[model samples]
Target chain A: MSASDVTRAIRRMAHEILERNFGCVDVVIVGLQTGGVGLAERLVDDINEIEGTEVPLGSLDATMHRDDFDLRPITSEAATTIPVDPTGKIIVLVDDVLYTGRTVRAALDAIHSYGRPKAIQLAVMVDRGHRELPIRPDFVGKNLPTRRAEMVDVNNDGVDLGEIS
Target chain B: MKALRHLLSMDDLDRDDIEYLLDLTERYVEVSERKIPRIPALRGKTVALVFFEDSTRTRVSFATAAGRLSADTLGFDVGRSSVNKGESLRDTIETISAMGIHCIVLRHFGAGAPWRVREWTDASIVNGGDGRNQHPTQSLADLFTARQHLGDLDGRRIAIVGDIKNSRVARSNAIGFSKMGAEVIFVAPRTLLPASLEGWPVKVTHNLDEVIESIDVCYLLRMQLERQNDAAVPTLREFHHEFGLTTARADRLRDDALIMHPGPMNRDVEIAGVVADRPNAVITEQVSNGVAVRMAVLFVLIGSRLDLVEEQSAVA
Candidate 1:
């Protein structure tokens, strides 16, 4: 996937979100920390550009809520800023890549500490299939099936699938 | 990055580690600001608060930090525990570790208790003031509070006043501040000052009034009356008159200079009542930051272990 591919995917995702949510009323977009933050911000901008209406933006860090905490390196924490009350609001969780589905699960657990939202919807720039858990993204930009050893890198340059080595 | 297993002393951390922990503390500070001031960081993890000494602030601070992180905290009651039955410290620590405790926040009258406990158990040891050895977390909180008011610690002049010989807070703060590039000045009467400033990287002074004008922070240490001998001071009145942070001395300090104390303060003895409660006084903020700092420490130790375990399992 190229940079233009990512841009087009983001625009499509934004339009899909607006169309499905029925014009963005009470809709909130939250980017996962680190990778998802930039993508979420861009998605919010795209949504605003398309609808000419403002939507609430937030960033959630799922480091502490991770299930694989005891097996990995110490995860660095990022700021979780939910500017508006998530209660009774539609929460659209945005992320860069959906791999193990563990991170999204962690994000779901982390969000409860904030407030119980009416609904939470997951949006990913790319869904590389190799899930260890029974989790799925509500909105996916691209669904790329890959081996377990493969890595997906998503950024301004767009998404690249390559071997870990 | 390499994970810190035990925080036995301020010496165990470098400038980078201190800065990292302080930065990590900002996240917890944000968590604390939320309507629900709790996180699932340490959920399902157990932490033991093993205090052989009586401490209201540090003990409560660690407990609150663990609770906010959602960790199960077991406050070891030295009063009722097997210590009363003459069980050894080593045995007690091993027994607790055997029960699957993840971390131990220890406070003991004997210096190096945490360091020794580390040899006995794999549980990460956090020194919550070991005798007169070191209170690394208190220093971390002090640094956090100082940074809150003073902005940056680099080249900041900090005068650690009062009982230097018996103050673990002073010892830890001296090492921590200097490591962070702060100029540390030890202020005390001749008797109260350490016999030798030999190895420590700090300027020793007998007069607080002279340096009060130049200092960025007047960090007053409690005059440990219980630890002091008759020769340590002529009298409490004379000590307060000469070395204490009296109103007159406080008047000489810079307007922006911060007044700090590791409580509970002996109001009239080490610092004037008015000085302690003044707007520039950040003693309360230090107490509040204490929880955040400890939470950061706990997360780094226990959280890292959890991560490492999961990583190994994934590899397997």
Candidate 2:
């Protein structure tokens, strides 16, 4: 996948979010740290281009709030930027890849702690087939079937591809 | 093999883990007091100190401690690191981890920053100091100093003086002392005490004189000037006048009682010079013990079997 693919995904995701959640004029696109944050910003830009209005961009680090807190180590404190009011506003959670659905769950828990959002929608670049929880991405760029043993890394910067064995 | 997995927060460690670390420090303390003080525990290990925030004492002490344990130390000032160029903290950890670093001592300016680093790697990441969050080693050093002077922290009165609201050291110490069965009295101006203190299982006091003499150990905390952005305290002079440990106040304490500071002491601001230098003072001792405590922490988190380190290294 080239950089153009990632760009196209963002553009498509932004349109879907605006069309489905039509009544929600105030929308916040919150990225989950790393790759998700960059994607969220790009999506927000795309959303602005499509709707002819600005959307807020926020970033969150779900390390501490993760259920697998003990399974792995803690991460460096990422700057959590919630630019717009979450109360009664639509929160669209963005990530590079949606695999186990744990990151989204953690992000949702973290967001509630800051403020109450009217609703939340998840958008991901790649939706790998296996999901450990009852979660489905509302806007998915591509559905790449992946095995549990393999790892999915999103190169939103240079190329967009899932690395698997 | 590796030195430490990480020191996220003190709460991450259980009671036995804390004791194991203390016991390790005890052995190192004996070594330091001996004619020759050197250990090969970290002989071939490399400790990388990545501090994104300004920390004079924590950075220096950790480096000195790592050196004493025979570990090669590399200190990275964030002002010069790739972080200044907008490289995320996680990427920086990954970059250092790839360098075959045995341990990473990180002092980040954000609260829970170390925990954040912990998520990124399996290497032992020590929290040099996090922003108004938890400074586990400082508390460990404080506890070590208190125990060294007072024999045991159990049932002893420990008055944590000054800047409770913004001092992670004080917060960690309060919890640590309490866990050790010591009565922790948080002595500070009403403005400086954390609102969370009410939830803490300890007595809080605004008047220093009320709890000062009753305590076996007076733990002086340096005023966190960084909290100046929040105006955490109204005035430094007023804080000193009301809560600072003066020479006159020192006269009232038991002779055997200890005066401890986690240093880079605020000197005239937090503690009087005479008391700070007094025979009962364990300020310097804390610095020395910091290494031992850190060594123990590194030892446990990395692996108890140092022999296996060679095998692990060969495999890597």
Candidate 3:
């Protein structure tokens, strides 16, 4: 996708989120570490612009809760920061790309330890097919499918599809 | 940089390694603060506790860290093994290695024993404490806890007082704190200090009174009760009078100055009982951070390389 397209999607997603949730009084926007942080921040900015009210923002890294820990080594990519208890609040989990859905699974496990959220909805900039787990994104910017080994990298500039050298 | 296969000493970690481990400890600290206080980071892994000395906080801290990460622990009963059956350290290590453990947290009465254990086993070795050599995790805990209260340790003055010669905590903290840009001062009776501070990166003083008010962190070390018999001090009372954190000395400290001790403390000999009750005393927080630091160390050791198990198997 192009830069304008990405921006437009984020803006529209923000409006859709506000309309569905009825103004975000109980909403917490949690972005996945590294990849989703910038996107989440942008979404929160858009939401704030629309509602004139700030939503609690947090970033989470799910390396600790990953099921593939034994098969592959993992490192904590970033710090998890939730400003308030997520109990009884709607958690809008954001990620840059939704592929295997394993990270989302791990993130679900990690979030449970904090507090049981009233509900969790996944938001992704791109939803590429090839899911190994039963997980789906509630909000999407784009849908692009490719071979398993191909890489999908999303940034503020745009989305790039390429091989990882 | 390649991640460490063994956390054997403070010397094994450079500034980047120390910074990474401590930063990672912050995340574990957050996990600890959560309602569940647990994670599955080290799931399907096992860490063997191979302690050859008496311990309380360090042992319990390691066990708790492992449990929070969902790692299983196999504790070697030191009481039944070498002391009774006369099996050597070599014999015990080999036995644990044969059981296919992933990591070993070793505490021994002899210095550099963890290095020898590293040679005997492919499982990663963490120097829980080996004599007066090093206790890197405890140092990490100290750094984490101190940073929590006082922010960055950079340019901060820390007075590590009492039993300097016999303390592994002193050795580790001296290196660990100095590495983080803190100015470290070693205070003790001359006899309790190592014969020379020739190459040590710290200031040495026989007086705590001079620096007490000026220092940012007053770190008290336990006065090993056995030291009195060894004639290091004429009496426990003299140690208290001279170097201890008595009410008078405690009163001399800056109100915001931090008080830290790596625990199993000598209540009256090193730190006064009432002084420990004060708000600035962060000895309890040190114990709490100890578990988080240990969890970070374990996560670093176990999850450092994704193909570690494969590499180990291929090598074997």
TM-score of each: 0.93, 0.61, 0.92
Worst 10 residues of 1 chain B by lDDT: B304-313
Off by over 4 Å in 3: A22-25, A69-75, B306-316
Ranking by TM-score: 1, 3, 2
Error of 3 at B316 (Å): 26
Best by DockQ: 3
Name the regions of candidate 1 deviating beyond 4 angstroms: B306-316
List the candidate numbers ranked by lDDT, top first: 1, 3, 2
State the lDDT of candidate 1 residue by residue for B112-142, as single tens digits. 8887899999888999999888999999999
Query: What are the per-residue Cα lDDT tens digits for candidate 2 across B1-316?
Result: 2333567777766665566567667765644543334444456678899988887777777877776666798888888878889999889999989888878888887998887788887677888888888899888887777777777677999898998888888878877888777998888877787766556867888888887678898889888776667766667776677888988888888777888888788877888877898988888888878877776666555434533554556778
The sequence of per-residue lDDT tens digits that candidate 3 reaches over residues B52-83 is 89898889999999999889999886986764
- Can you list each candidate's DockQ? 0.52, 0.01, 0.56
In model 2, which regions exceed 4 Å deviation?
A1-165, B1-4, B34-36, B230-234, B306-316
Q: Report the Cα lDDT for candidate 2.
A: 0.76
